[model samples]
Target: MPQSSAQVTAAEISRIAGVTRATVSNWRRRHEDFPAPAGGTDSSPLYDLETVRTWLASRGHASAATPSEELRTMLRLRAQSGGSGTSEGLLLVVLAAASHSAEELTAATRLPDTEVVDRAQRDAESAADAVPATGPVRFDTADAAVLRALYACVRDEGGQAALGVLAERELEDSAASGAYRTPAPLADLLAGLIPGSPSRVLDPACGSGTLLAAAARRGARELCGQDALPVQALRSAVSLTLTEPEASVTVRAADSLRADAFPGLVADAVLCNPPYGVRDWGHDELAYDPRWAYGVPARAESELAWVQHALAHLAPGGYAALLLPPATAGRASGRRVRAELVRSGALRAVIALPAGASVPLHVGLQVWVLQRPEPGGPERKSVLFVDTAADGPAGPPAGFGGTTPPARTRGTARSASVDWPGVTARALGAWRAFMENPDAFEGEPGVAHAVGVVDLLDDVVDLTPARLVRASRAEVDPAELSARVDATRGDLVKAAKSLARAAGHEDWSAAGASAREWRTATASDLSRGGALTLLRTVPDSVRTRAHAAGGEEGRPETRAVITGSDIATGSGPTGEPTGLYDGTAPVIAVGDVLVRAIANEGGPMARVAGEEDAGALPGPHVHLFRPDPARLDAWFLAGFLGAEENIAGASTGSTVLTVSPGRLRVPLLPLEEQRRYGEAFRHVHALRAEARRATALAEETARLLAGGLTGGQLLPSREAAEVRGQGGDSPH
Candidate 1:
């Protein structure tokens, strides 16, 4: 593939030319010598990369793409060849960098483009064993840009970043995102279960090796992993090697359950979070396999199979923690195996987590911490069951399955996030106490319990923590619960008042007939016309700097940074500012408009900076726009930029939809008319803010009241004598 033939989108051209989308549009309309569309639709056409560059150069425009973006663009173009040659080239970069000393590799990167390409080819041939079989690694002048970016990425961000981009592109092509990566909190919590730093750790289905990485952080000297996908195996290998340079890393691309990659190897510890609802996990063929020591897992008992597999590979008395779906604890067909696990003293603990703790966000998952029973080990009498499913606070409102990560940790507010820190504390506390003395362990009321193994040998040996430890109404304190309900009710009353005011301010009516259409211009065009100035924190700069700038490397300090999370919550700059940030980080001013970089549900996409937000620096995942105020209103620009359709139109990326500031379009209305629209949008923002607040308070109030009433703390007000039956309305 020729470098010049690579195609780029209009947005890419805008980025490369250091101009806005509007400027690109203006160029297309005004210049006859502009590059023609090489691909894509008429509305969103792609142009030949070389032709566009020549045009830009002829027009005195400089290339402004960062190294990563340039490499990404080239990779997308290389994919048009329907081959893996470019990927092999990328892999070559990582391997070469890893094989050579940092100074040597840095010296190599400074070589002339022609010599560098040649050196990369030689390095690829030398280190071919490190990467998967991707076609022959070849590099041409066209790939020089990618080669340079890859070296820089490997050096600055580590090999993981370069490999991550390749993995993302491959996943997008395959449309197969295996089980989501294990959440870091959950991974650390699982790793903390192992008493001492085990010498060896293995994850049979390590999606991205998150579990193994966590284990390494806990002092594991050797890490082994296998996955069905080659990309994942490679990623895990590179990531683990980078994570623990001293640990021995061995990753294989295979189906571990069927292929048995390390059949004779026994690990000191095994941590796994296998795929759920897998009906075809080699069930029939593996019926006679020896790993099924507990029992032959039923066809629907894939989780049980993983459980047994983890147990099979563990050394005597070694620990294995598996993240299983909630169903595994109570499934009827898997009852026999469940009983055997308990009877053999292999099952140690079953902790139920709250919903939103991981993927399949609606159903709460369970973590099964087990150990291989040793002949000389102390008698195992009980298994710890900690039901932390409701440990934090309330979850989202009924049926509210929003996909955004929770922005705030307000105790009773509902969001799509689990209180991981809180959950870790409670679960670990119970487990540690139980381990010290299982018999004498005094568990927290309604939260954790140590159950006797003898009591769980029945036909239905259910291990569900919720079933065993749901908060008992009789155990709750009447005075405390009643006081909580009253406090919640008072807050709800205030929220209701605010909601009423917001609701009353707007009596929206429909456009009489057909909806009116308006002429619009891209934000880039507006910027070119001096209507606004667009700015974003330098991509890839903030994360590295944030870590380097941490107060002590554990907690990030972002005292006055306006983060994307803060924007999602619709608050006035509650973000902390890291000491280090992008060199061009913008300090926001009042009336400036801000937009989130990532697309999500349950929140508005854009917000107008307020007085309190005036001097806050924008976070990496945020875009800032300072409007002229004479030509465009901040609210009007934000309103249109955040319109559902406009956002959809401008967003890109496979998993996380990122907003392109230049691509966002707005209506070209007169200043006065824009103000009129801005006023309505302001009211809309107010209405939405109040609605969210009211919903959160209402849900919290209802949950607290329900708990109080069910726990016998509060009596129904005048039951049969209530007004509904006798006066205004029928109870039914």
Candidate 2:
């Protein structure tokens, strides 16, 4: 097939059109102008890109597609040409964009197609020269459109956008399974599990390099990664280079276990979300592999193999965090290895993350934090076990040490709606406490515990955190629990009153005269005029110092980092600041407007930084907009930018929505007029905060009350006694 004749699925058409998939199906059934299928099977047919564009244009739908979507269509066309050259060319374009400023990329992309292609080829060659280890890349006129799209994507959405396009195309081409990405929060959690700042980090199965990126953010200087897929390796390389340009990165395309790319490499920390459940993981071939410091893993215990692989790569006393399936803790075949790991003090902690935290969301995944033991280190006494599954929404399933299952499911287990911040706090707190004093660690009831090594080396070596945490909770003093319940109830009552006041605050009237149309300017336009300055975290690079002070290799001093999750959850910064403070990370200030670079369905997408948020640096996936107070009102900008429609309109991507800060429209109104709206928005924010507090308090009160009653810690009041007397029943 010719490159220009490539076809896209109906789903792709819907994505380009910014509509539901059903809308495209309706177009096909109802409109004769709809493009006919060029190829593919009945259930999943493909359409010619040009034909679809022509049809969409004829119906005035051409303006619906974002630049990224258009570029995706073009890349799909090139990919269907029966060659991988176009993706490589696009990769080159991304590299070039990263090398140059956003303005430079925009200027180059604006040139004639021939000139753009020529420029892309030159830039690609230059990028290859800089990274001499990568194979040579070639670009031609056929790649011109993609080059332009790639430039636009990088400029408008950052390098990750371009990487995402290439990754999607490659994943589609390869038809890879078990290819789910580690959510940023989960990756951060894994990286945080390491006891100290690691100078060098390794992720053996570094899919898309998300974990490596997270590690880098945590001040890891030298990053090593290996993946079985070439595209993934290439993607990780480009992504890391672009985002963490200062970091030294080496990524290889080969199975880490089979090829052992970094055989002699011992890193300060190793983080992996390895592929789960592979019967054929070279068990026979690696029978004598020294990486298995613990008992040899059974063929069915591939997760255990990854556990050991991670451990093997860790420097003595270094930590390794691996995301594994729940069954890995108790699977009979892996009991010997689990017991050995426990007895040897290699396993430090087992954290049960909530379901929906990662892929295969039905099962709550576990993160096993291990330490490569020093030959003469003090005998390890205990391992931290934390169960955050019941700490968030979609609480543990029936008989999983949680309250009785609700009549109706709150949501599908696959939904990404878990309380990540709470989970991180609980797990980290427990781990830290246990690390400080394992023997005397007074664990959080029903949440975390430090289990003795002797207890874990029993007949059935079940290392599940929930099981251990539940047993520990049962040992808590009833009087202490009652006191806690009393305190929580008092707090809940106060919260209810506050919520009522905020909810009743009605300060604004409806706009008259049919919504009052007004002219507007984009955030980019305002930035150009110096009305505001937009800032984001600099990519990790060896040239740049790590965030924390006293970092290895003289890295820069670190500061508190405000993550996107923190903004979404309306919490203070929770992540450790590990990157060098080189002024690239904007220190947030009161009156500044902060917007999440990624859009979510139900939440305020932007916030006016308050006094509490001031002095904190913005982290990755967050946009900081500091307005010239004389020219712009922070609340006004946040009010409009955070609007659901504005966010939806400015976002790109099919699955995860990436916000285009520069393109987000803001109303052009006088400061006085803006203040009125800002005040209203501020009130709304207050109401929301109060409501959230009240809801949390209510849930906590219910849980405590239930626990108190069920555990026989509290008795019914006199009112209940009178009711029993009326029913002619004697009190026991």
Candidate 3:
């Protein structure tokens, strides 16, 4: 094939066009002008890339692919041209392209094919110098289109986008088992479990470096990661570089348990979400490994091996947080190791997170936080156990009262839906409180508890947080419980009234047109025109100092940080202020529009900062649009920008869609008209908040009433008997 005649499979065409494979098949069958097969078998015909582009353009379907998708197409084409297994080489080129500015990338892609390859090779060499065990980076004429795609992807989307593309392609090709990306929010929660700031961090079995990236966000200056797959290691390196360019990052392609890439190195902290339930994790071969300070992990105890590996890499007094299958905590095979970990004080806390938090979504994963003991530190006494399984964004988890569970995806058993932000807050609040004063730790009833090490050395040695929390809740004071129930009932009544009022607020006439349409401008255009100011969190290193100083020197201090999750959940700012008066952190003001950087189906993605959130700093995962009041209404912008369709259109990525703030469109409207819309939006927000509050209160009330009645703390009133006799419904 000619160097310029890069051919792509029909599936690749579908990806390029952002359409389904069936759609591509339909196009091939129906469109007479569709390009003929350039190569490949009858079942999997390939089409010329340029020809396909031309046809798609004629059909008004050209350039529909996101940067990542485009990059994937080019990588596959390069692999085809390079004979085979050169996708890794293309990945190197992608990384190199990511190192350059958009303008530089554009200029480089315009070079002759051979020069593009040469430039990519040079860039790859420089980029790969930091990664260990990475062989020489090479490229040829086969990589021409890939080089262009890499450049364009890096220029338009981001280095992270390019890395994601490369990782997806590599993982798909390798057929890597048990592969899943850790949700960013979950990763953040894991990172937050570490008590103090960690200077150096390591993720022994880092998968695409999500946990390490979260650690970097917490001001970790040095990042070291080892993944068995070379693609994952390379991806991690590139992602870390893009996320925190100043950090010293070293990612190696090796099984940390088998190869121990950084054998002599210890880090200030470790964060990992290692592959689970691997029976052949070199268990027998490495039975006597030094990393297994707790005990030799059995073949069935692979998670234990990973846990010990993480612990071994942590410095004295440093913490290692691992996300593990709940089986690891109570499996009889791992009981000895679990007992020893507790006895030695290395096991600090075992938090049971809600199901649907990550992959194997049916199982509630447990976060094991361990701290390496100082040579002669005080002997460990207790382990904090937190069960946030029933936690939600507003209050307790929804669907109480034996309600039929929400429909779940096939092949996965129904698991309680997780309120990520609420769970995160609950976990962190308990962990931090315990860390501050372990000896005096007063556990939250039905949520968290501190169990004595002696108490946990039983035969079962199960450290499941739910078990401990259930026991704690069972022992709560009846008087206190009664008071809480009474207070909750009062609150529920008030919330119901508020919801009723909001629901009954003035209604507006619908647009007469069959479909609503309006001229719109991108956030970037509005920002450029000085109609609004956009702000995001600074890098961790700077943020840490600002947080430490309660803001930048001489700047106004913030009381809280409003996160994307808070906006999605209709909650007030949930993040504690870094107290960093750094002016770099945008202080949210009332009337400022806040949009979540991530898009999910759970809730609204945008909200206007209200009095409750005013003076708060915008969190890293939130975008702040401070519109000029004279020109724009905050709620009007929020209403349009937060529309589900708008978010879906502006979002990028395969599973977790990341919103591009600059791409968010807002309809232009006069201030007076905008306020009219804004008022309606405000009422809608109020109604939603009130509804959530009412639901939460109702669930709480039902639980309390059931528990109180069953435990004989309260008896049914005479009115209930009279109502039942009068044919009225009885309170269950």
Candidate 4:
């Protein structure tokens, strides 16, 4: 007899699998060899339990693990063919029996063998409702071990190296978003800033346990982390477990602010990367908290409150390292806290990391390393301030640029070149030297300086990075700087001139002088005519990644995922990308005008290709518009789509900006005019590419120069560049 429909969704599989209902959705992008539908077409497939297990087994290459072995036994009783009441009846009986067998196995694994056989016989009899529809299947235990090892290896290596292991299962989940985990190198540097090994390390609002994990790696045993989100807790727990299995870790799921889970818990070290510019944080509840020995936190002093909380958790002589928004240093609301902290010598050093180190990408963050005031500690005198911001002119890398790359196929994370090793080494070395003998540690010009507390209490009370780092060589010739700027400007102007001459046969000389009225249509209208197509609607199976660019390595490879909040802002994906799709296979063809489907105004927009961008797909968050070459010129469509008219009209959503494809309209200009427009587009792309390359080169130059100068690799000289050139001529 076949099992009944009641056999499918059993609690046993749901519990041990630790998989969510959403993970079961094989909607589209990956999961190529998913189970054949028990009853439905490819468009709406639904697999029976036995078939799903079988399919899962096959992918694992037949492993003799507990689940795989049990699955084979269950498959033997599934319905062979047709909707026989026998098969249905048998399936239900088998499931009920299987449930009993599971409980027995759990107990038997810890009991005698005789009892196991007795339980197996009882289960077989009860499962008489099940029939042998399929033959027996077996797997080797060694095979399952190999699979586990492979998975572990890839995760340890990185996403690039893990592609093979990840290929089998989809990874377009939130944890796998383009958000770069803070490099362990930088984390170690921050962790080393603490004087010695702390008995307990607490990371409030820890994201994925990066800093805590790093602390553990550096020999800290007791680790504790807390976050506001359950997902973050889960991810952090998993990551921490994977990184430091021997170390004790306690991860709590609660807002660090509203609910103080570790209240009154003092630690040797407290590390945090708190939320920025968060107005909704519970300031009122914590107003009278005893942690505010530094000062009472004003309404706008949310960061100060966090600082105090970290300090409260610090034992005597313990230290706290916090990554905070720069505004907190000089913000009026928190001035008292800053004053008291510095005056008491609880504040140790303030280091300014380069821009794009973390979020608030435009405004570089400051690392405030503070020590708990000890009863009779060595009387503190001077405070150290290291400003490494404006350290470089870094931006996104080749593969994931805001604009398409020249050789599109060879894209890699932009931060691959960011010298994290050099940065970390320099910071750690300086810190280590200072710790060894504070008096002997002298500031290197343009890098680090130690100033007395009295000197810092000036009128401004400002701790801006620019004010701390000594000035570099004064500006080069203004004429030379202006010439470089003019050269760039001239190239852009020339490209515009070429575009005018090429588009609509407009005279190159007259394009700037003439103004003419013309008929136009919305991009939405043009798309409706089959003149273009948008590949924004992703199927359920496809996985995508979205991340913001930043970290130690300037601009890391990332995709901007949309959230519900994003949807409210404008027309775009409302949340983070959730699945994986083939990057190269699903290529966005040339002439596709890719715009952020959702964003506030000044949202980024770019054309699909330049003469160089071949065989590349738009990363997530972008909506690709493919105009029919027969009807519309790609470049012409790009220009029109990018214009304010199309952007504003297509835009939708409240908090975020979004545009329905049906609503975007464009000009139905003549074919010749469209071709001319296309030519202009090509020139514009080239100019943009040149500009981006120039910017990258400049940034690279700046980073190398900063590291060299600050690390004492380059000696001070009036003409540093000239000195470097002359040194290159000498032999070692």
Candidate 5:
């Protein structure tokens, strides 16, 4: 029964339900069953404590309350169903306003200013007594109108579109304030792994509530989110209310690791993507905590601590999904915890997600799906392992959806898109099938495998998916290998022939003795030649800006924004351009020599701009030299810039060396010779283009071969011959 001694006010109800004062009054008048007055007149009519308790417990309301009353009750029920306590009530008001805006509410509700303030204060005071209370007050004291405006905007806009706006305002502010939000797609996938329908879900380290929001969307009614950062708490509260108006979201702004907010509470499912490799996570205090049933996590295994926390909150048969770095799988410091989890049969499946999916992008991340080991649960014989690093749809150029290409020796970060929908469907499908029939689920070749527990108890419980997926045997046909070798040899021979032909064509070495090496004329000297005018004026960066401004290749309207780094990296415009707003810097008309003011101490640098790139201003990162239009053709300067000798003369410095304009040296070759060199430079340019095209073709060929070979659709000719040689023997 509601406590009669507690004399709760209408304002108290508003604070508890997170709506305005008028909403509470309307509920009392329109709904016959709303708590009856236990004391005083209409202005100060008291609510029967028991009646209030019953109202709170009934979860009942007519479908046709006034529009304003319906909205208030919707917010109230959402908070209640989610098991979110009173703190979130203020958030409800903000969400209410955001749903339609305070201005609209003020205009529509027509409640007096004193009434709104009095009711809000009373509600705030009453809510303080409610359990699990701690959010929305920050907004209660601030602009309630702004909160309403945000809700109205989001309601008019779609959820995803709202996120874009929120990202710039709330997300950007939070990011700058030092809290990082996990990408949305990854959070959705991770949360999707939790088993069954959950009445309540918790994210111990819920940063911005991505996982919790996903859980609520998936039909979870009760949501509890906690984060150490205040901004995270605020952002999450706003986000959760916006998404699941019926979900009760209780968010606390405190360190989950240190404070232990919901000490004795349990949830049906726990979804978390905690901070990775945190060095200081309250190890000493939690060392003997009863939650460490699997094993006490070590100092280095912060993820293990989060795992234990998740497990602690899970009811019997509840599931927990954790997104963890791959390092946690085989790290020795947490061997016992890993072993305990496996032996106890709590670990269900481990799947590796593609790289470049998150920060520390080079490292492949794994999602762990764990079921709390129940006393009477059935025994598990195997764990499902999926290697999706290379299994999904095609990705970016030069790589197969992970950090480094499988063919590369060194690890480096690379950009690629994962077939997110495809990957998630495949994984979730496999998991669903496995749950239906564990032993019946056979391993897919190079895709997923259900390895027996005994097999996994090797020297190291190394759960890297790559180590488990067996590589298909090479089906090299002898004739095919021979043909490939022949083709490579032919290319090599052609290169050799070209070397020989060029070697005989010119002998600068033989002529060196006859013509004493003249005093080396610096690039600066040749640049100042009567025929060649220096074009090193525009900074290198501007060229890139202009090039980028030039829309895509076919889009003439696209302007190019050039920069010095563009020339250095050989990258074209990224397709976006920034205008030169600041006054005229250095204009590059055409035929300019763009020099690297900062060059590698012992490396070659500098390139001459072509006529096509003229008229663009160089960014501040480069020095441009405009060639004289009458004396020297731009191609001649470009040829000189291409030469190694000219580059070496201009370079300066030992460590962080920079090339100075005065250090540039150029050969005083006759105009005819310069023109001849220019012709050769054009040929070299064409050859380089051909080489790049060949490289691209070769890469595509390798990818096709890899795909066909792995899919068992292709076999080498030698393998066919071997089968033929064996005469009807199965080529197993």
Candidate 6:
């Protein structure tokens, strides 16, 4: 390819050269021989990749990259020439070719470029039945590098990995980047929620057929799905067939709500994770949609429309599980539908998941487990409500002991670590129990409760799991509450005292005039100097091993994954290691500095691994910096690397700032000075930790006190000690 034919930005050059983006700009400015802009706007000029690579090689700049990265680069370069339609068409080629054995793929890549293209075109045609064609599939000799890279990616990284890149191109290009696959754990949970093992399953708004595949695992011999995106529909059809070759799979490309693909089909069950909060799901046109058996969903209530659609496709008494945003459970506009579902006994259970469970990771989403009402069957008496979001099992009555991410950190808070297995178990246990005997089911207090439908049918018809489950929290053991309150108060008092001491221990003085300036080195520079090591978990790699014996509990072979949430919240590692990694997860030792991968919020960015954090594996969205204690101080490194200015300078991307490890710079200082600063930062970390713990405890105590008061479990403080200070503040 001509040097000008393939181009990249300064960021891409930085990545290829393993240097900071600033370094690339510096090279462009200072080196007259540096490649000039080959294309793109003046503000964001693109350099020829071949020219840049040659320049970097001549200068002895490091450029040791893996084949996966090479493939990604080739794909990016190709995307510039090939439009999205071509990309979609090419994806079919990938899925088709992915079925070939690694040896077969490797052997094909060694052939002449012309032969490779011909072979790839044959592969695309061969899987026509598995991956239905959305458009014509074609490849030129020019695409040979991409063709070889594609097969290599499938051969090395796995087919799903290659497919993800292609799917991402379309999603990002179309500005639908929020599209994400349902987590496999959540998929299994949804599949397990249905009362019986469904033999014929349907997912109306299937994305990638995750739910349908889950159903397949549960012995569903006939699987059906519909999606609005052709790419997704094609991908799902192939994925479902691959997952269950014996199962009959039918996936059509069409908006299920706007265009009913299976209007007359009935299924044993429906499992869906539909789009949320969409206003134009053909609502005005679908106002009289027969699927609106419950009620005509308001434009804002697209979730209810999906719920009814699932209901419409079900056999009588067949169950449906839909993952919905929390708003859907309590939105006033959907009250009529909620009431109707409750009255007809169609709505069975509403389970709240911990935040970070899936996309829209910032919000704690809910799962609505519903069953179509069978005519002349048993009358529905109550609705089951389970709250996994709160600490009471947890929620406001109790909650996951996770610190709120700093106001600036927007998505995927530490609370995401609330145990997935625990959440699944609790939800499934309550659901199975409820289904077995709805009338006699007495739910676990503070976690789950079965509320009479009459109570739910009240004016609001609000079915938020936390609200319903919270009322039962007051029924939590009074003795347990009293003991917890007293113990937590003591701990809080100790933490308060510690916070005060740490705050008072600071001994540094600010520079008098201009802020102090010092020569600094990027973290990558330090790594080159052997002062630190960077480590990260390949989430995809780690999931393969998730099938091992233990979970996040740290068994003999199991390692707990320390996620960004755990670092931000000062909580124990909550990420369940998906048996995902190949070998061992990056092990954290004391003195290892951890940084959040994204600069989304204002919360603390880094913390030194304490004794409690040792031995745990680093999770996604967490960057690990294990400093050689002899050469660097962990706290000192963490303090400077996590500074707001440093993170801001290092981060890239609009809307979501992703920190670049190679860009994070720290000041060069003597070991003695570093120790002094490290000590102070240590105290600061202690102070912050204590403050977060104290705040959470105080909140919990206040909740307990309020519940106690309202439930008549506690008396007024008539005998309480009075304050001695004269100020009104003391009295208050």
Between the candidate structures 2 and 4, which one is better when assessed by TM-score? 2
Clashing pairs in 3: 546-580, 550-579, 550-580, 550-581, 551-579, 551-580, 551-581, 551-582, 552-581, 552-582
Q: Return the TM-score for each candidate structure.
A: 0.72, 0.80, 0.80, 0.45, 0.49, 0.73
In lDDT terms, how accurate is model 2? 0.76
**Could you tally the backbone clashes for each prediction?**
7, 16, 10, 52, 69, 26
* Candidate 5 C-alpha RMSD relative to the actual structure: 24.6
lDDT string, candidate 1, 364-483, tens digits: 889999999898888888898987675324222111221212222332212453545446666777788788889997675466777889888877999989877754445666887687
Give the per-residue lDDT digits (tens) of candidate 6, residues 1-732: 322268988877775665556777888899888999999999999998877888888965544333455566777787676623266556666666656665687887787877877888888777776654466778776777677877877666556656655665555421144246787778988998986678989988787888887787677899988888887888788667654656898889888998888989989999998887788889888777778888899889999999999999998999999999999988889999999999999998999988877777778899999888988999989999998775532322223222321111123463234445456657777777778788988776667899998888888999998888878865667787688778867876887787777777756788898898887877877888899997755533123323332454323336778877567666667655542343545788888899998676455889888888898888767889989888898889999999887887666544456676766888899999999999888878888877766666666667557767776666666434334343344636
Give the number of colliding residue pairs in candidate 6: 26
- Number of colliding residue pairs in model 5: 69
Residue 531 of model 5 has an lDDT of 48
Q: In model 1, which regions exceed 4 Å deviation? A: 1-4, 11-33, 39-44, 57-62, 81-89, 98-116, 125-145, 155-158, 173-180, 193-196, 354-363, 386-450, 491-652, 658-697
Of the pair 1 and 5, which is ahead by lDDT?
1
Those runs of model 4 whose alpha carbons end farther than 4 Å from true positions after fitting are 1-181, 360-362, 391-417, 471-732
Better of 2 and 4 by lDDT: 2
Query: lDDT for each of the candidates?
Result: 0.74, 0.76, 0.76, 0.53, 0.57, 0.74
Evaluated at residue 15, the lDDT of candidate 1 is 58
In candidate 6 the C-alpha lDDT for residue 203 amounts to 87
Residue 106 lDDT in model 2?
Answer: 73
Q: Across residues 1-732, which tens digit of lDDT does each residue of candidate 4 receive?
A: 122231233222221122223334532236777644565455655456555556556643222122322232233223222222222222222222223323333453343334433443344345332221222222222122222222222222222222212211222222223222454445766787887778689998776677897688557888898877654554565456534546887777787777878997889999887776677677787778777898878878788888888988989989999888889888877777788888899888887776545444455678889889999888777677776544443222211112211111111222122233334444555556566677766654455667777877776667665576554223123344344444544555655565455443422344566775565544434554577776643421111111111122112212433322221222232122222222322354445566665444232254544433334444444566777889888777776666665566444333234443444446668889888877776666555544444444444444444545454454456797588788896555
